[model samples]
Target: MKYKTICLIIFSLILLQGCVAIQSFPTVARAGDTVTLALGSSDQINIADTTVTYTPDGGVAVDLTSNVRSIFKLYPDRASPAWSFSAASGIPVTSGHSASVDIMVLDLPPGLVPGTGVIRVQNNAVYPIFSDIPSDADVAIEIVPGVGSPAAFAYSLFGNATAGNFTSLEAAPHFRIKPDFEPNAWYQAPTYAAAELTISGTLNAAALAATESQVTGQLRIIVDEMPTSLASQKQVSWARNGGDITINYLSPTGKMAYYETTVAVFFAASNYSFTATPNVSIRYFDIDGNVVTGPPVFIKSCTNATGCI
Candidate 1:
């Protein structure tokens, strides 16, 4: 009876040993998330070939690149540089039969588009027994937009007062003219005396005797005397055959100094009209020769009309 009891006890111990659970440390990680996997010492398990596959929940599986596998082996205690399958490190049992592996995901390059995805990790080993295991993890990425900076305004003048005609009295006076501009940008325009007559060199006979002196010798003048910060009104005038003709002035800044010159010719009547529309074009550009914006600048015959051309 005692011998029978001993046999039964030995059988019970063997059954208990078999029932002991093999602890599995399984983890799921996103493409950019870090993870760690460990096995107990008694398991005598070693990693032979490890790989991670990615897919959307309902999409097809795609193998993780060797670059990604190499990144996973960078952990000092988790991987052996000398032993690898593909890019994966072969985990070895050194002092302890138990071992742990660490994995990490890096940021994707700008070429990758934002998307939703999932990942699975697998381990194939011989010493411990080759097995494929998978765990589900989610991935989320976002794309940002690119924007350009605002451009600056440029200034220039086009008239008979260029460098070539600098010494000639026939040359028109220099006037600072601001182009029509957008908000928060800079501009300049001519300033003239209000209700006052300013004299310059007398008009030549060719100009004085012309049928329309106002149009033939007309000068488009500009000035920079104004503060460029305030809006003010000024008057412009010139003598034709020793008679005063009035022109209109509108500037944002209060007048600091006056700018004036005679048009080469004067019309017989103040109401004399032109065959083509008289208009000035204002163009804005940046330092790099790129056009920024533009607006039409009009000049009306103030001697007759009150509005702009």
Candidate 2:
């Protein structure tokens, strides 16, 4: 009697989870800000080579590159540097692992139509011991339609310098900044990308033309980076052009890296924290030098708040 050969193959994608779960901040995220995909650790799957992708709501798929093996892999419950606020996301892990990624909304690959978006994660087998481990997961993220938010972020203008404390106009607009993540562990370093902020507003061109003559920095933009019990700040120096002032900072690549930081932007006249009247705009940008997110800050003058002096 002769016996025949038999083969059995297991499909991991069919057994794995793609849209595991997403835990993001501010619930509602605007363009230019940062959003997160809360994929648990990698130890659960027995091996670690995973990939990330972004598919805008009503758009195409975008590949997100993350190399864990090169960045230090974490086991179940073994906190990864990028896992900031992971517990809040409720990632699935008992025998499984999860990882979290923080991405600037604008950095996301442009969606086909720009409506709803999804983040997908997949684990591939890199060796024989890790074979048959092809699995995938998905998470949801909503992209709002406009750039400027109605948040409390504001700015103050100071063209008329009074003993270094500029006596200027003020305006506040909506603003939300993506905070930076810190990875205080071995082999953990967050990646950084450039984030540029454009500060602009209507000037009493007439008043400015008369006394101050231009919308220059007397009271410049301010940066606030804080933690629960600790806090720090700095004044942002901007490159000014008539009514537009540009501020730039390189944001960390992800929440995964250690020894990195992030901050928010605000406007002030000189070094003094003075209030402003409405009539200014604030916006955000990408490395491409385009407006990715923000609203025009509105400004009003001490002499006139509307229609140039």
Candidate 3:
């Protein structure tokens, strides 16, 4: 699980005629998100390879040198972000297919997220080409929630595990509501101290006898870019910066669970700033039963711990 592929930031310099005719172009990225990888040329050969590596996720499996893209119109100097290697930097596939290069998805850090982790590739110039994806269409890549954005609650180490491809297993939520508003728009939670957010403890009993499904669900809050199931938000009074509340759960077998839901959120008369996206999903059964869901642990809380809460 170490496919850190965010390389190549050339400014302008192309000339590597050896073997790697650049191929395999289908890169769906996340983990810091910054994508653009189109390497063509299936067989209409016009050689000149660059370099690329990092393929870990079950290990060894490569094939990418399929070229067919190079027309040379020559005209790309967008404000000194240069990177052109002759042959018009290759881009025009159909003979054998290959032409795409815009990589930038750093380490993919930050826990793992909602589930879905893998970024394999193989085409380090000079005759390299590795990518087999196609088990029926290899599945495990979901990070889609953009409308203003704010639905990426990371930390999924593959979530409890059963095989992969995310199946859903909640219980990683803990929000005492009311922080910063104006995200999804529609705020009203001022009944003095609103309260009414009761979730009395009980994650003990050896994790409530190791679940199988009953891990509960909602307990939301997410303003910036919306999605706490649609912020419309409400957590009224007491906002001395919602005094100390941190969340992060998931312990069906996936480990790393945490909680701290004590929000009263003082400081009304609002301009909004909230953030506490919880969804709670932790169904289990790994003794052999095999149900697994775990992967909803997000607690980037905010009550002015510096401002951008």
Candidate 4:
């Protein structure tokens, strides 16, 4: 009777071993990175009659049984405004134990600001049989902004002049400017007239002529007094009494340099009675002395008599 009991116990132990022989899936991924679930030994396990299903915590889950391997992928649900993804084939796990279906996350989609999400993986071979083989992993992503390029100057005008310079007497001469930059760089918009203008006005013929003469004499003195680190300097003289005016610019080292064009305005006494419009083109430069080469922006100045539009 005892020998019979020992045989029965051995048989029961063998059956128990078979029931526990089923292999379990493993999860792989970084705390803040993408999740990849790998089925190490799908061939060694008795999954011929079973299907494996996985569920991600914060990303899209894909089945691995479609491919020839046993590898699955999960995409995180993070936000990145400028993120994007590309099409990818399934990653091979083993020779014949690869994923039945290939799954991949495209380049992070643009406009995914940045954040964290959860990813989960599970097996759905047989309902309630091995369905409890679910695993979860955390995923995190970060997005950063790009740098901006430099800009250049096209044209500029300073001081008062006759209305004939502009297309419309009603519209003050507008200055158009541009900047140079790379295709995808962030640039701080420049602020105009931020620095107060120490001098502004329309001088009559006599006044203009006198100012020009004085400027010629004072030019040397001014250059000697200016600091060496200065980049460039400009001085404009406009006549209100229907006369011609001149503009002179000096470089940082006190030498007369012509980096820009000049326009001469002749204002007659008759033109003085009407509103005068001056056209100016301004160029923006960075600390490195590089001109911005972007689209041009317009700037306008008008007198109260022009209906103040």
Could you tell me every candidate's TM-score relative to the true structure?
0.20, 0.26, 0.17, 0.18
* Reference-based lDDT, each prediction: 0.29, 0.33, 0.25, 0.26
Which segments of model 1 are wrong by more than 4 Å? 1-48, 69-96, 105-113, 126-309
lDDT of 4 by residue, 1-309 (tens): 674485344333322221211211112222222222222212112222223333333545444333212222222111211111111011111111111221221122223223333233333222111211223222222233332221121224466432222122222222211122122221222222111111224444444445444434422111111111122343333222223222323233322112122221322333231133433344433334555432332223322122111
RMSD values, in order shown: 36.5, 21.9, 23.3, 31.0
Report the number of clashing residue pairs per model. 22, 45, 60, 66
By TM-score, the candidates rank as 2, 1, 4, 3
Better of 1 and 3 by lDDT: 1
What tens digits encode model 2's per-residue C-alpha lDDT throughout 25-139?
A: 2334555444433333322121124466667766667765431111222222224222323331222212112232112112333322345676665653221112222234456
How big is the positional error of residue 128 in model 2, measured in Å on the Cα after superposition?
A: 19
Give the per-residue Cα lDDT of candidate 2 at 87: 36
